[model samples]
Target: MKRIVMKFGGSSLEDGDKILHVANIIESYFKSYSLIVVVSAMGKITDELLKASERAEKGDQDYIKSFTEYIKDRHIKALKASIKREEVQKETVKSVNELCDELYKALTGVALLKELTPRARDYILSFGERLSALIVGGALIDKGLRVKVLTGGEAGIVTDSNFGEANPLMEATFYQVKERLEKLLQDNIIPLITGFIAEDQYGRITTLGRGGSDFTATLLAASLKANEVWIWTDVDGLMTSDPKLVSNAKVIKSVSYEEAMEMVMFGAKAMHPRAIEPAMLYKIPIVIRNTFNLEAKGTLITDRVQVDKDRPIKMVALVKDVGMISLVGGSMVGARGTAALAFSTLAKQGINIMMISQSVSEADISIVIKREELSKAVNSLELNMLGKGVVREINYEDDVCVLAVVGAGIKYIPGIAARVLNILAKEKVNVFMISSGSSNSLSLVIKEKDSKIALQKVHDEFELDK
Candidate 1:
C-alpha cells in the first residue's frame, strides 16, 4: 500500500471548523494512501502556554493558578465543540485535566526556582501538542474515521538527549517506525502522531527545538519510506519572498532541495531547514500546500530540479538581530593553529557561530553570533586570545543582518557577486561582511534595519519577476 505523511501546523487546526476542514482533507486523501497525520498545537495555544510558563517563572503563583484553569477551560471548550459523543467527551476532559495537573506541578517548581531550563520549557511546551493530538484524533474517530493518537516517542522516534535540540537516531527510529506503522496499516488504522517531542535512549522527553513538528513529519516520512510527505500549513506555498515584505512576491511552483534548505536557513517562512533533510536523504518529494485551499497544488520540493537561469538569485532571505565579530592580527596571518584556537574559544563559551568567513592568509576570521550572546562571546574571546597572537582587534557589530542569495544554477554563472554588490551599493546599503562558497550560494551581512531594503534592492537587481 502507498503511504503518505501529512503534517498540519497550528493555524491549520486552530478551531473546530478548521479541524473539521482538516478532517475532510484527510478523508479525501486517505483512500489513496495509508495516511499518517502529524499535528501541532491549535492556534496560539503554545504561545499562551509559554506566557503562562513565564508568569510562573516570575513567582506569580496566583497567575499560575488562573492560567492553569484558563488552559484547561480552553481545551475543554474546544473539545466540547468538536467531539459529540458523551463518553469520548468525558474521557477527553479527564485526560486534559490530568495533563493540566502535571503542567501545574511543573510550573510550580519553575516558580519556586524563578528559572525555566530548556528541558523544563520543552516539557511544558509539549503539552500543547499532547492536548492537540488527543483532540484531533478523538474528533476524527467521532467522525467515523479509525484513528490512533501517539506521542512522538510512542510513534517510534528516538532522538539524542539534547533536551531542546534533539537529533534523531536514524537506524533505530526507522526500524521501530516501520514495524509500528506496518501494523497500524494492517489493522486499518490512521495514526495521528504528535509532532516535535521525542524520547532519548533513557526515555527522557526531549523536543526537536522550535519549528520542529515539520522536521518530525519529514523524518517520519523518510523512515516509513512514504510515497510523499505533505506539509499542510496556512499559506499556499513557498513564495518568492515574504508576502508582507514584498506584495508582488509570487509562489514558487517547484523548488530544488538545495534552494529550499538555503531559503529556510536564511529566513524563508516556508518550512524549517531540518524538515527538508530527511526527505532529501531518501529522495522523497515534499509538497507544501495550504490546508484551507485544498485545490491548490502548492510547491513541490525535489532534489536537483532545474530552474531558469535568467534570475541571478532565486530568493532573498534576511536573518535579523545578527552580530558580526572580525578577528584580525598579523601573527594570525598564514598561521595554522590560530584558526582552530579562535573557533575553540567560541565553542567553549557555547556561542553558536552562524556564518563565518576567513581571509586568504587566515590572518582575519569573521564570525557571526546572536545579538543576545554578543557580550559573552566578545568578553570570552578578549580574555582568551586578544593578545595571544591568535586574535588582535575584535570588532563587534550588533545591528547586522544576513542576506543569502541561494540557487544551484548560480554556480555555473559568472559575475553574480558583482551584480549583487552593485545593487546593494546602489541602494546605499553597506555590506559589513560577504561570504560565498563554491557551492553557488552567497551570503552578506548588513545592518539589521537595512535588511528589508537590501532584500528589495537585490530582488529587483536580479529582476525576479512574479
Candidate 2:
C-alpha cells in the first residue's frame, strides 16, 4: 500500500481556525493516501506547561493552577471551534476534560512534592501532544473522516529511559507500529498520532527533547517504510538563509540528506537534525511544506541531489547564543586518553559538545556548547580535570555563533571554503576558528553580532537568492 506520514507543527495548529485549516488540508489528502498524521502541541502550550512544571517544582502552586486552567480552556475552546457538531463536540470535550484532569493530577503531585522528576515532567508536558491530537482527530471526525487519536506510546514509539531526551527503540517500535497502524489502515481509519512523547521500557513517560515531534514523525516513516514524509510548518520551507535575517533569502528547491542534516545541525529551523536520519538511512524522501501555502513545491530531501556544480555552497547557516571552552596544556601534547577523558567527563555531566576542535600540536582542545551549559561544562572540567591534572588552563568564550556552509560534495569541490572565507573577509567578519569536512559541512566560529551580515554576504556571493 502506498503510504505517507504528514507531520504538522504547533504554528500550523495554533488557533481554532488554524486547526480547521489543518483539517481541511488533511481532508483533501484523505482518500488518496494511507496516512499517519502527527501534530505538535497547539502553539506555545508545551512551553507554558514546562514553565508551570518548573514553577511547581519551586513550590508555586497558585501559578500552576492558573496556568493549568488556561491550558485546559485553550484546548477545549479549539476543540469546540474546530468540531462544531453538538454531539461530536460534546464527546470530544469529555476527552479533553479527561486529559486536563490527568494533567492536573500530574501537576498537583509536582506542586505538592515541590520537586519535578524528569519522568513526572515528561508526563506533564505530554498532555500537549495528546490534547492536540485528540482535538484534531475530533475535528477530522466532524468532517466525516474516520479518525482515531493515538499517543506516541500507543502508536508503539518506545524509547530508552533518557527522561528529557530519549532515543527510540527501533526494533520494538517497528513491530508495534506496523501491527497497530496497518490494522487501522486496513479498517480505513486515519490515525491522528501524537508526536514527541514516548514511553520507556518501564512504561514511564519520556520525551525526545527538542524537535522531538518531527523526530517522531520521521521515525514512523522509517519504521513503516512509508514512501514519503511531509513536514508541514509555518514557513515556505528550507531557505538559503534565514528569511528574517536576510531579506533576499530564497527557498531551496531540494536538498540532499547530508546537506539538510548539516543545515539543521548548524541551526536551520526547518527540520530537526535527527529527523532526516531515518529517512536518509532507508532512502525515503522527505518533503518540507508550508501549511498555509500548500500549492508551492516545497523542498524535497533525499539520498542525493544533482549538485549545482558552479555553486558548491548550497546554504549559509548560523547558530547564535553559543559558548566555547578550551583546555590547554603542554602535557596535552601527544597525550594518550586525554580526548577520551574530556569526552567521558562531559558525557557524565550530560553536557553536549556541539562542535569540537583540537590543536594539531595537542596542546589545546576547544569545544562549543550551548550558552546555557557553559557554566556546567566549565565546572565539570574544573572539578574533574584541573585537580586530576587533565589540563593546565581552561578558557571560555561567550556571545559566539557558528556559521556553516553546507552542500553535497563540498570536499570534492575546490575553493569552496576559500570563497566563504573571502566573502567573510570582504565583509570584515572576524573568524575565531574553522573546521572543515565534518560530514558535508564547513563551519566557522565567529562573533554573534556578525552572523547576519556574514550570512547576507555568503548568501549573495553564492547567488543563493537567484
Candidate 3:
C-alpha cells in the first residue's frame, strides 16, 4: 500500500472537538493508505510553557504550581471530552497526570535553582507536544482505530546536541525511522508522533525552532519516501497577500518549490522555509490544506510550476518589525574582503541578515535584520569595521519592514523591477533598500508605517487578488 504523512498545526488541534475532527480526517485516510500522523501542541501551549519556564527561573513557585495545574486540567479536560470509553479515558488521564507531575517537579527544581538553561527550556517546552500526542492517541482509540503515541525521539529522530533549534542527523534518522515505523504500518497501526521535540545522540531532549512540527512531518515523509505530505492549518492556503492587509487576497493554487521558499523566506507567515527543504530535496510534493475549510482545493508546492503568462507576480509578501543598517566609506571601494569582514562580524554575534544590497561603487552596503537584533548588529559592525578605516560611518533605522514580490514568472518578465518600484513610488512609500537577482523575488526595505498601504498597492498592481 502507498504511504502518506499528514501533519496538523496547533490551530487544528486546539481543543477536544478539534482533536476529534482531526481523528475523523485520519480515519478517512487510514483504509486507503498507510498513514502516519504528526501534530504540534494545541493552541498556545508552547508559548505558555515558555512563559512558565521564565517564571520558574525567577523563582516563582506559586505561579509554577498554578501553571502545572493549568496544564493538567486543560489536557485532562480535553481527554475526558474526546475519549468516550471509560477505560481508555482513564488510561490517557493517567498518562497526562504522570506528565504533569513530572512537569511540576521540573519547574520546582528550576524555581529552587533560579536557573533555566537552554537544555532545560527545551525539555519543559516538550511537554506540550508529549501531552497532546497522548490525548490525540486516546481520541483515535476511542474511535476504534489502533493508535500508538511516541515523542519524536521515541519514534527514532536523532539530532545533534543543539538543545534548542536542533537539526536531525538525517542518515541515522532515515535508517532508524524507516525501520521503526515501517513495521508499525505493516501491523495496520498508526503511529501518532509528537512533533517539534527530538533527542540528540546523547539522548537529551531538543527542539526544532519555529514551524518545527511541520518540519517534523516533512522530514518523516522524505525519510519514508512517502508519495505526498499534507500540512493542515487554519488558512485556506498560501495567499496572494496577507488577507487582512488585502481584502481581496486569494489562495495560490500551486507554486514551485523555489517560489514557495522565496515567499516564506520573505516572511510569509503561513509557512516556513525549513519545513519545505527536506521534501524539496527528495522531489516530494507537499499540499497545504485548511482543516476548517476542507472543501477548498488549497495549495500545492512541487518541484516546478507552470508560469502564469498573464500575471507574472504571484504574491506581495511583507516582513515587518525589521531594521536596516547602512555602512559607508570611500575606502570600501575596491577593498577586498570588506563585505566578508562585515558578514563575519555580524555572524559572530549570531545576528541573521534578512536582505543585503551593495552599490556598484562598493562604497556603501545596506543590510536588513530583525529590529530587535539591530543594536547588536550595529555595535558589532561599528567595533569591527568602523574608523579602522574601511567603514567610515554606520547608520541604522529600526522602524522598517521588508516587502517582496514573489513568483516563478518574475525572471521571464522584463522591467518587472521598475514596475514594482513605480507602484511603490506612487504610494509615496520611501524605499530604503532593494535587492533583486536571478532569484524568484524582488525584496525592498520600506518604512513600517507604510507597509499596509505598500502591500495593498503592490497586490493590486500585480492583480494578484484576481
What digit string (tens of lDDT, one per residue) describes model 2 on residues 93-117?
A: 9998898888887888888898899
Q: Quick one: best TM-score, which candidate? A: 3
Which residue pairs show backbone clashes in model 1? Answer: none
Q: Model 2, which residues run further than 4 Å from truth?
A: 344-349, 375-393
lDDT of 1 by residue, 385-418 (tens): 8776567798899888888887766777788888
Task: Report the backbone clash tally of model 2.
Answer: 0
Deviation of model 3 at 11, angstroms: 0.9
Cα distance off (Å), candidate 2, residue 238: 0.8
Worst 10 residues of 3 by lDDT: 263-272
lDDT per residue, candidate 3, 1-466, as tens digits?
8888999989998998899898888988888999999999999999999999999999999999899999999998888888899999999999999999999999999999999999999999999999999999999999899988999998889999888899999999998899889899889999899999889998899999878998899889988899999999998888899888889999999998888888877766556789899999999998889999889988999998667777898999888888899999999999999999999998999988778899999999999888999888988888888778788899999888888889877788787888889988898989989898556888888888999999998888878877
Higher-lDDT candidate of 1 and 3 = 3
> What does candidate 3 score on TM?
0.96
Cα deviation of 64 in candidate 2 (Å)?
3.0
lDDT of model 2, residue 48: 88
Q: What are the models' TM-scores?
A: 0.91, 0.93, 0.96
